[model samples]
Target: MCGTELTIEQSGIPEAIPVEFCYAGWQESLQLLALLTEPEIPDQA
Candidate 1:
């Protein structure tokens, strides 16, 4: 079950999950990080 808000900018452009989301369960944290870094955006962009 996903219960985190992941705004584009809020995800550090696609490499970081919002710190708030990190407060959730351990699984949620991993999921959030995955979702946050899922975008194929270049690391240098």
Candidate 2:
């Protein structure tokens, strides 16, 4: 096995995956801020 330490943000973006892709439990409607769920908004005049 191979792994390295990271502070999440330093790791940048990861490939998108279904929220229900948890290793355990029924996560059909899961939300994690660390996963960068919020939509990007443009600056309004």
Candidate 3:
């Protein structure tokens, strides 16, 4: 979700609502979310 302004008053939170603490720009931020959500894999011998 991408937009020019931060937020809206009347309509209330447009479709471009980003996840909390995700920030606005920088693709790395999105990647960070993916990494955090990834399941931990056990090491195989």
CA RMSD of all predictions: 14.2, 13.4, 11.3
Q: Per-residue lDDT for 1-45 in model 3, tens only? A: 753333522335456765542445445765686688767999998
Off by over 4 Å in 3: 1-26
Candidate 1 on 1-45: residue-level lDDT in tens?
855674443334334766655555556767778887776777885
Runs of candidate 2 with Cα error greater than 4 angstroms are 1-35
Output the number of the lDDT-best candidate: 1
Q: Candidate 2: deviation at residue 36, Å?
A: 4.0
**lDDT tens per residue, model 2, 1-45:** 744333322223245844334422232333354346666789999
Clash tally, candidates in order:
0, 0, 0
Off by over 4 Å in 1: 1-24, 40-45
**Position 13, candidate 1: lDDT:** 36
lDDT of 2: 0.42
